[model samples]
Target: MNERAPATSPEVLAAGYARCAQVTREHGTTYYWGARLLPEQSRRHVHAVYTLARLADDIVDLAGPDPGPATAAALDAFEASFWDAVDTGTSPDPVMAAVATTVRECGIDDECFTRFFGAMRTDLTRRTYDTWGDLLGYMDGSAAVIGEMMLPVLRPGTDAVAPARALGLAFQLTNFLRDVGEDLDRGRVYLPQEDLRRFGADPHARVVTPEWRALMAFEIERNRRLYREADDGIPALPGASRRCVATARVLYARILERIEAADYDVFASRARVPTVRKAALAARMVTSREPMRLVHRDRAALDPLGGTWVSDDPVVLLDDTGSPVGQAPKSAIHHDDTPLHLAFSCYVLDPAGRLLVTTRAASKPSFPGVVTNTVCGHPRPGEDLAEAVRRRARSELGVEVHDLRLVLPGFRYRAEMNGLVEHELCPVFVGWADGDAVAPDPAEVDDVQWVPWEEFRDDVLAGRRTVSPWATEQVPLLAGLGPDPRAWPAGARDALPPAAALGPAAEAA
Candidate 1:
């Protein structure tokens, strides 16, 4: 079973995601590689869900001599814990915690889990499916719900659900054909008994006779029909999701080609899609869909503030402890009476240790034309603060900065100018870029300066240069870190006092 390291820190969640990623990459190569196309948020949730399902499947299929009531009891206990986690927004079990978080964040219904476990419980008692309808009935929970659970994470349009189920069934039916011999060895036959009798393919014989080949050919065609039914739903998904599902759909469909290549001899050996083939197909899908993604990138893209942050996009509302409680529209924030919310500030430095500073565009907003750090941004709903900063760096400064370290985790301040307010729990980050010359986006930045760290600090401290109120407060602290941004310690965020509690400093500014 995949295990999560205990802790609720950001580092711990990052570590948990990594562990789940390992399970995905090592155990489900085709699915994992396909998942690589998703955005980070969607990809991690998919990994968590896959890890959960794999754990449950292991209990049902690999319990060996304990595959009776004992296995059933363990599964029941697991389901109970899953529900508990769902209700509480957390779980002591690492895998469940991740799954529960995804379910909560994505708004997936709990009914999907109930239906899935119902099918898993049936695995202990059911042996042979009597007809196609019976096989499909079992597959509904065992297979279709897998696709239903993924709907929220995929964010495909609602009309795609039925097709998603069909696609899932197609994949599961292909697996049944491939695993016929293995299932028979376990005293079960996943193939419907009516199909076996119709094709004269006896489950007891376990041989690749003419009747078996004919039967396999028929079942392969049946699965192919389901794939075609699923093809219609691909357009309903977002670009990255479309690419991901397309890759998985195409790769799984190739299993039929492999089976055919072996003359339908699934019983002799398991027919598998080669790793090389999977890679080639995925590459083709990615390249083919690349242009479409670029066309749609701007509308869904994160702004320089590290969020959609348009006039209508949601800004995360923060509680006293800096935990998110709710959200308000971006246009509704930044007034004289603005509420305390989560925000971020980033400082970008070049390899030569020169700091990149910018003056905000004089587009007539609050603090317009004020000189500040490289760029400051706010987190979008459900976005990680660090990730948002990197996005803002790229979108605003047109510079790629790496290894950003949070320098002030408890940073907060409230300043009012005219009728505009700047009240934020803004964490600070320091990042290193490749060169001193950064291409600034004219819409957000009016002027850019790359100044020696010591010179900039001296000017700010000597009161020889005017800057934003927040910048005035931060420059002194940044100067204490010495010249090289890369040489900054990992515990930098601990060096500063809580920004919100600095009442005197705010008053002076």
Candidate 2:
């Protein structure tokens, strides 16, 4: 090196990036180690993005509950400064300069930051979130957009966008669960109030009660579901980027496991993956082929009813917004903490106006050996729910359904049978098999019966006879339509869930 570059040369950019890296290392060890596997240029861009987010988050969060007008003005100034640097491609502030450079080099969209800063500003005054949907609204801006910002730098295929956003949401949700007590001190509640009321959990008590455990179990499973969503996109990345993201995913997901291992007592102690564990994970990711697979697979084996990887054809998984976040094997998703999924139930009718019901095969998984609706099953990925109903009716009962009218377009429920939970956004249907004989497949149905619709409805309503949880809930609603099953009005086609609004209309095939 005959001559060193002046500070006015490329060294200025290098210094900014170096400073960004130092900030990342100090504040975000998870990110710091994850980015280490990326190529040099890419790694610096990642650090710059993290530094920008970290600094912005500090301005909002560190202001305390009473942020007042001053906090908003300060945040506005920080954002304005960043944008000015972005437009000019330079800044006196080292972190802003590095971030602006990364944005210019990677072509990161300014809209992502707009949404992110909007969300940060929301935190200034918003004290609590009312529902899962409401909370996701905030997370979409604060967390999901950050993933969007990172996508260009990570340089995976465009298909990875949804998964990347899912990873962002998953990471933030984990942080919320782990830091609930800390968040309480800051006058924030990231957990949905609806979920808290449903489980009767009072996090403020800082005690590990049964309600809190149940609530955390539901949330942790949801967090893991997002991780699975994110995993779908990892293989799309180039080698080192894939390794870096995988390492980060596994390490972050492990925090959920830690919360579980500590008996869901998050308030008692902050759950974490130790620094040594993080370093070891990073090392493993570097040397291993398919590092993500082994960690998730080992964790899946811990599930009481196996894991959500039982088939090559995956079942679609939905978030609170009813969007397809990812897909998983149908066989493994119906355990005690079953995540939300798409499915349908059909009531088969004969010419004599009798509703066909069947007792499930004893060996079958989930609500087995119980008398329920004529047919019920998950729609295979890309297969319409109406098509699924028609398919399931044939395979399970050896009959083809005609007049498959969707009777309940928005039916959802959570029920337990023998401690195994079944949950689904199952649309209800009414169809007739016409002349088909009552031939039940021994593998799917133990017995079949055709009871008058009124009798079955009254039986369930009066509790004189027991049936599947969905059947019990459905019969009452089905009865509300009319006396004659054939005369029941079909739900409007447009009322179906978005993913289900596909294939042929709810008409006779």
Candidate 3:
């Protein structure tokens, strides 16, 4: 068990809440919007739970190149610290303190939190479910745990657990359906294997066919059944909380409808419920006076497995902060090592020759306060430079280019990122826009804006523009290429040195 001092001060709790609100507002509007609907007194509690979950989820999903080991270690330490805080009745971390308060206030058991952590840990290993039962089990631990925790806050002394679990499965299934292509591209497939097999489909197999469509339809129908089952528990909830749950259900269910509208072609494109549709769903909730129906279809499914798999051995917390309890005592079993690795970045320039930059979202691992190029991402396993660049440009910028000129090939660069050795053999490409307006992906590019090329170049050279070291190195090289409309291989150029090494006389056109 990790040992840490408890946070009892009001200032620390307030600061923690503020940080939670700020980070959640930037990365997850869905959660932030839901929190806003809660009563003022309950908002902090909800935000605390969201912040902890968000941080844990990002530790696995957004830790950047090779996050596996680090993410697992971080989660382990977080869980240890969380339990220690609960025992001591105080936490040095503000977020943990708020969570502790919420747990106590709402009578939230350790099972829910432990189950949530268990689900997150699955991200380190489980990428696909062998059966629909397996996928529902995953949802029961992940999304359903959240609903179970909220039930106490929303409607105490009520057996709304079964409905919450069903709703959670429905919500997660809808999310999986909508993000099929995106998840598949990330080396993840959330669709159940049993349904895929039943439809003579393999999610991992190359090329999606009519069989895949039938499989998707069957899965969607399963989600609809769960959605109906979950809706029964809503009326049992408090009147104020009922509307929010209804809205969330309607909003998520509409995503499934959108996927159906697209003819279940999730392999080719993603599905989304537009804002207008969301508004319509909310309106329907308000206008319709349908009484909440309570169903007791799957009581056993709702019951959490008995007993925890707790190891008697104590786990140490690696705080890394400069304090007595911060550093974990070095052990003979394992030692940390730093190794050199590669990274990827992009420079988004519009047809007007203006460079697009975005402020890093708070959820990102590096330079969250800093601004960087418009479209940037790390290469996935088995992906080459050109494919990685093209995929990232399309995914992040939401724009495809048919003519991408490889301006600089095989240019190696080295830099230290967050105390880790970063190495890359970058292949810079110049993509010309073809009257397609910019539609930056909010998940990657937080706030996008175009800066004039000459001004951007000057800023880079003059040290006025705060950009990534790699981007700082590539910007001037790209600017020198000018607005030449040439295809790739025809525009290959010699590699350039670091931006600082370039003299002022050479930088000025």
Would you list the C-alpha lDDT of every candidate in the order shown? 0.75, 0.82, 0.60
Residue-pair clashes per candidate, as listed? Answer: 2, 0, 4
Tens-place lDDT digits, model 2, residues 277-368: 98998898888877666556645224443322222357778876566888877754665467888778899898888888899887676777
lDDT of 3 at 486: 39
Of 1 and 3, which scores higher on lDDT? 1
State which candidate, 2 or 3, has the greater lDDT.
2
In candidate 3, position 50 carries an lDDT of: 72
For model 2, the stretches where C-alpha displacement exceeds 4 angstroms are 1-12, 295-356, 359-371, 378-394, 397-455, 477-509
Worst 10-residue lDDT window, candidate 3: 327-336
1-509: candidate 3 lDDT, tens digit per residue: 22335446878777777877887667554555545555766767667777778888777776543457777899899888778767675688877877776676666888899899999888778778887668778887788888787777676336888888878777777778777766766667887776577679876664567887767766775666677667667777665577657666666666776777877777667676565655555555555555232122222122111212111112122212211121121111011121222234555466776666677554443344457665554444334444666677676677665444455554455654432233444545555556547677655556767787678778887899888777788876765666332322333233422111112211111
Which candidate model has the greater lDDT, 1 or 2? 2
Cand. 3 TM to true fold: 0.52
Across 77-113, the per-residue lDDT of candidate 1 in tens digits comes to: 9888888777776676666777777778777877888
| Model 3 segments more than 4 A misplaced | 1-7, 23-28, 63-67, 205-208, 267-269, 276-509
- Estimated TM-score per prediction? 0.55, 0.78, 0.52
Per-residue lDDT of 93 in model 1: 67
